[model samples]
Target: MFDMENTTVLDRPMLDELVPSRYALKIGEIDVLVISDGVLPLPTTMLAHNAEPAVREAWLNDMYLPKDAFDWALNVMVARSGGRTILIDAGLGLDPDLQLPRAGQLMKRLEAAGVNLGSVTDLVLTHMHMDHIGGLLVDGVKRQLRPDLQIHVSAAEVEFWRSPDFSRTAMPPGFPDALRATANHFMEEYGSHLRTFESSHEVAPGVVVRRTGGHTPGHSVVRLASGGEGLTFAGDAVFAVGFEQPNWHNGFEHDPEEAARVRIDLLRELAESGEMLVATHLPFPSVCRVAAEGEVFRWVPVFWDY
Candidate 1:
């Protein structure tokens, strides 16, 4: 039985003053913070499954979020522990090619949080999507954030993004090739730091990689455990829990069925285990818990009064 109601954790403010959307969670001696790079607006039709027009329209209308547009919050997580700074996903770096407004605010927020990119020793890439890996390189040539940090990505993910299959498909315009090139650049610049993890292996002492393929072929999630606290970094597995009702597929999922399955399983696991989760596309801060009532699942924002 999952608690479908909000917990006492939400009583506190979760975000920092510099970036109102970003939030920080403390686990033992580690500091895990989620920073907002920006947001985007997409069509609701692109997100809905082939369902009744009236029903979907009604749902969107009731929520007040325009059916013609869906707002997606972009976030990147930074982990600091044992004097080593690690960044989970890079946000959309400044790019004339990308239309998203939240592009390239990592360094700004980091500085606001009193963090220097040069101190980062490792980078854990959940997947190589443009929004997630955009900040990996700066101005398309320099490694701006972390010049000396090791960048770890799953081998399967690396292969999939680099494959010609991506470029050959009818992907959203200007998405495939540019993203592929970034992946190649990362591999080249940080080959020594570029390591791969199997399906379920520990990347750091308290951070482990869990496969949750769907958004991308080799997409996965990150689980952080330290002391008595636990949290999962659900990268695009379940965007806004609103449209992704129950165990439904996200509209942009490459393989909708796979995305639905992975999301359902993840919700079930989170509900049963009572662990915390932070999704990239979820609202800023994006931290919540899954609650199961009968067959319907809901996201209960963690009451983190920071």
Candidate 2:
């Protein structure tokens, strides 16, 4: 069984201070802001789910990350266009009892940026996982962080997450507590703004949603374009520098093979189209340029002065 009884509140001092070089980037007429919610402490064994021992080991070594400690970064993206503000995903909320201090800093960063969370017009949830939806609710009262912001989710994702079979599917045992709580919070407090879209739907004028299921039954990716340049917000499809190697499949994916295929195909398409890729877990300030190197790929960090 999983150890899921901790109710410790996360504070600023318990978070690690690992900020990405790029804090914000402007594409066309839109402003894309990146904020870190902190990182997850996962084990290396979690990445080799279906892979052979040797194969997984080799991939781990190639990535240069610790084979024993596989911690992943969690970042949130905020976009502004034509007087509209949208948040890509909610960050992991505060865990006050944890040692990490920097978690739950998105609100502070937004305040510093002069953007109010309450004024956000829309919230595009890529998936319903804890790291992505934990911040969706306010602590204690079970209320949405932005009660007025419209919430857009793929129809399939909503159906899968709310389905009776969700518990039977391959999920972390602790998934129910947080995810179910988030679902309930949304249903009760913010159901008015909840909107579900079908495949390849548009959430806004320039914001397009595409189905990229793998990590979850109905995972979706957001594509934004303004002025002329294109920017794609890949929720959890590419975590960290793993986007550089499209074939590198982490164990977090519910369907490793399908995830690998989506990653590889996305890398190829993004490489050719020259669209800026936004990685929710690719180090905070999580926007980068991807390049194809033979059969593999590489990440070129986009430097912003902050």
**Global lDDT for candidate 1?**
0.70
Predicted structure 2: lDDT = 0.69
Which stretches of candidate 1 lie above 4 Å from their native place?
Answer: 1-19, 140-148, 164-174, 181-192, 242-247
Positional deviation of residue 133's Cα in model 1 after best superposition, in angstroms? 0.4
My TM-score estimates for the predictions, one after another, are 0.84, 0.81
- Residues 1-306, candidate 1, lDDT per residue (tens digit)? 111132223333432333474577776666788878777666666555544667778877877877767777888887766666778888877767665655577756665665567777877787887777767566633445455667777777877755635421234455566767776776676567677876866666787777677777778888888887888998888766433474444555667777778877888888888888888878888888888776657788878665
lDDT of each: 0.70, 0.69
Best by lDDT: 1
Worst 10 residues of 1 by lDDT: 1-10
